[model samples]
Target: MRFSRAIATAVATAALAGSAAVCVPASAATPSTVAINAGGSAISASGTSYSADKGNIGGRTSTTTVASGTTDSALYQSVRYGMSGYSIPVTNGTYDVTLKMVENYWSAAGKRVFDVSAEGSAALSDLDPFQIAGGKNKAAQRTFTTTVKDGKLDLAFKADQDNASIAAILITPKTTATPAPAPAPAVGINAGGSAISASGTSYSADKGNIGGRTSTTTVASGTTDSALYQSVRYGMSGYSIPVTNGTYDVTLKMVENYWSAAGKRVFDVSAEGSAALSDLDPFQIAGGKNKAAQRTFTTTVKDGKLDLAFKADQDNASIAAILI
Candidate 1:
């Protein structure tokens, strides 16, 4: 959305440099008139349908006729005398498109002037009046490059002259590169030395140690490792953790590991506090020790806080928070 005139100028320069050869192919010889609508409705002939006889005034060696009645209804207001145009697909890069008009006939007292415009802006005008021998054909060439956004590129030409001809119209893509996308707002928890907080104020968490400890018999301390403490697990009573308010798709995975000698531990997992963890039921974890339980829940938080708890009838076995 940020428009930079300088960036557009740079793109135009690069495209012209790289596409010169492609635009003037040896096989391209003296510009020939291709079907004005060959590319699609996006490109067309404006005045008097592009005619090979219009003579190429632009540097482009190719030209086309728009036919007298083929003028676009929408662009009719922008055209006068005999005008026609062609459209080309413009990528998000820069481009340099040139059109050449040729004067076939001129009157001793009449002025022969031609103007060029992009979309509709008449920024390109004739350098001077085109002069041709009375009743004889003469050619003049003009070149100009403009930057276009990603989409269809429309070029229109109009002339105020008694008689004119077009030899060729040329459009070339000069260079292309992927533009970087915009950045998103930063959002995440912050850790300060030995102190963990949901706020992203600073970073100071203890380097080699876990900031907080949890009951090993239940959710062992250091069991979870994440920039956010939401990964840590707690016993069935479910423990509260701090979180910034925002829409979040919360995921919970429970792992119960109990050897035959450790006995079975029955447990259930749920979220609570700011939002009822039970409301996210289907996402509840239920099972016995040595078995893994998983649940996923999505909810919107407006109170900048998230509390999660787990309940278990235990004496020896326990469950660990696998992930959050």
Candidate 2:
């Protein structure tokens, strides 16, 4: 995921300045439904005129005609005009681009009606059309990732089909960043089980092993076994773990078990206990017939803590909780 390092730093500076943080408008395309002409710079159809409604982004519609033969390729022709072309100013960064083909139609006899390409020196050139079932409208999507120096982005699409219709094209920008590895917490084990805790006095959890198995080192507290009630609680019954105020993407891993639930387990998740956290609800697991489930959740940290809870709905299903 691409995150604005400058934005991250600015948020910290805002706290020192004792002022409301100014949000940087992340680079993105505003939502607007507009259609581009196909041939020149205007929408014109021969056997059938292309409707602007169909060409709007997210609502891809194309103009089509009822004609059969290798040479009957005259359906719609025009250069998409007046519609604004994207002139995105990008700095040195990685970006993800996606083109959504909302609507496409072709006759039973496969014929190449149109070709779409995103044009730029950084542009990728090989967007091959996958085989479509004959005689029906088809939809597909293409994606590309590229890095850019300071420059403007120019995306272009061209059509070559005889009686082809196009819906709308959509483009979005995403940042790419390398993540740092997490620091492993310390674990202390006794004859009963083990206890895991962080560097400071902020977070702690106690976990017990089943059948006298050696306890493993982990980050959070709580286990999937009903016989165990580890003490790795990050918050009180209704609070969440407090983090150092900053923007962060937090992830947690946990174990799931269905063996104790009389062969079936079901559960729902709830997050509470911290106000400094956002994006609380993480996951749900339904256990069935002696199966165990393990899963993780990712959330955005806004203030200082992240709190989470899981409630089972099975006869003996349970989950082990861990926080990163």
> lDDT for every model?
0.39, 0.35
lDDT of 2 by residue, 155-244 (tens): 544434342233333333453345655643422222223433333322234333222122333322233342222222222222255555
Task: lDDT for model 1, please.
Answer: 0.39
lDDT of 1 by residue, 1-324 (tens): 247888898899999988986777443332222222221233344442432222222332222242212134221112113436546554533455644333333322135555668756674664222221111222333455666653556667665543223444445555445765543233222212134433333333322212333332333323233333323233334434455666555554334433332224444445544432221111112223333333445555566555554544443212233222
Off by over 4 Å in 1: 1-81, 107-110, 127-129, 132-136, 160-165, 175-324
Off by over 4 Å in 2: 1-93, 97-171, 174-239, 246-250, 258-263, 272-303
Error in Å for residue 39 of model 2: 23
Cα deviation in Å at residue 309, candidate 2? Answer: 2.6
For candidate 2, give the lDDT of residue 272.
35
